[model samples]
Target: MLKLMKLPTAWGLRNASPFNLKAEALLTMSGQAYESIEALPNKGPKGKLPALIDGEQVIGDSSLIQRHLEDKYEARFDDGLSEVELADAVAYRRMAEEWLYFINLWVRWIECPTITRDAFFSGIPWPLRGLVFGRLQKDVKRTLHGQGLGRHTREEIYGFGEEALAAIAARIGSGPFFFGDTPRSVDAALYPQLLNVAEAPYDTPLREAARKHAVLTDYVRRCDQTIFAAREDLPNVA
Candidate 1:
């Protein structure tokens, strides 16, 4: 069994961090037994979550973890697809992870008018959580600005994000998963971010924009109802 260390679930999400959700989904879809361990924020290699431990080998990053699974455990992670389709999935996966991922961050750490920050900071002690949150918020904002997304207006950002969602929905078509009948490697990367934003508690512009595409909502529900259902080895957060 593989062990994945990541942040605990929060904000009405299973595994508040999308990378964590990606790891869990890959493991589940791969038919591999595994357990989840709650890891500290920005604690793993390159300061991220969902680091996988397989015996003596520790893998970092969601993409790298998926590759490790495919290369070492199951070469069929992207199975059932022609090379061109696999290439397309890889492109969408990158778009979801890099662009949509940051847009969701913008919503949470920048434009959100709700308790997302507080919920995230709840992991820390009472006195220091606020201070830590402020510091981290500044860092996140700086990162977003450097990523070139912070310059856009909220309206622009929401519109930009919705376009990406639309692309994913179209590519998924009427299929149960992105690549057709079965979940693809792209689904592992894309579903988490979509679920996190679309199912967010507040009715913000970003969430509203995401919800406009019926297929996007359905895709997320399908993924959640299928891969993200409760399991015995799931962990309890502090």
Candidate 2:
């Protein structure tokens, strides 16, 4: 059995971090027997959650995890996709994980700091909570700055988010999944990020932007119902 190190579940999501959720979704959809162990980012070799432990080997990063599943376990997430279709799927997944991920960070940590602090940091006690959240927010800002999104105005950030959502909606269109009726690895990558943006408790312009796209919301709902249909016992943050 594989052991997946994950962050705590929160905001009605399998995991508050989209990457963590993505890894879990891939495992679930692949029909793999795995154990989700609640652990911190530092616990993993890469200092990130969603690390998959297969015997003595610990695979870090969601994409790497997918590769491991495919190479080692013969899991076929892109079973029927043509070369061009696979390329397209990869492009969309990169956009979501690289670009939109920063936009989400801005929304959660910068735009709605109170919500994030209260939900994730309140357990630290009063003064320490303030200190810890302050440090974490600073680190996030530095990361975003290095990524170039933090330098933009808040409106510009949210505008980028809206555009990303629109693109995702267009790609998904009327299909049940990114490619068609069959769920692919792209769906696993896309679903959790969409859920984080559309369903998280925080009310930011980014969330509102995600909501405006009916296609995106519907896609999220379907993924939530279908991909995670078997793991209904997963806990949620109250």
The CA lDDT of each predicted structure is: 0.80, 0.88
Q: What TM-score does model 1 achieve against the real structure?
A: 0.91
Clashing pairs in 1: none
On residues 120-231, what C-alpha lDDT tens digit does candidate 2 reach at each position?
8767998989998999899999999999999999788888999999999998999888888878899999988998999999788889888999999999889867887877
Q: Which stretches of candidate 1 lie over 4 Å from their true place?
A: 123-127, 228-238
Clashing pairs in 2: none
- Per model, how many backbone clashes are there? 0, 0
Residue 26, candidate 1: alpha-carbon lDDT:
85
Worst 10 residues of 1 by lDDT: 229-238
Runs in model 2 deviating more than 4 A are 232-238
TM-score of every prediction relative to native: 0.91, 0.95
Candidate 2: residue 44 lDDT (0-100): 87
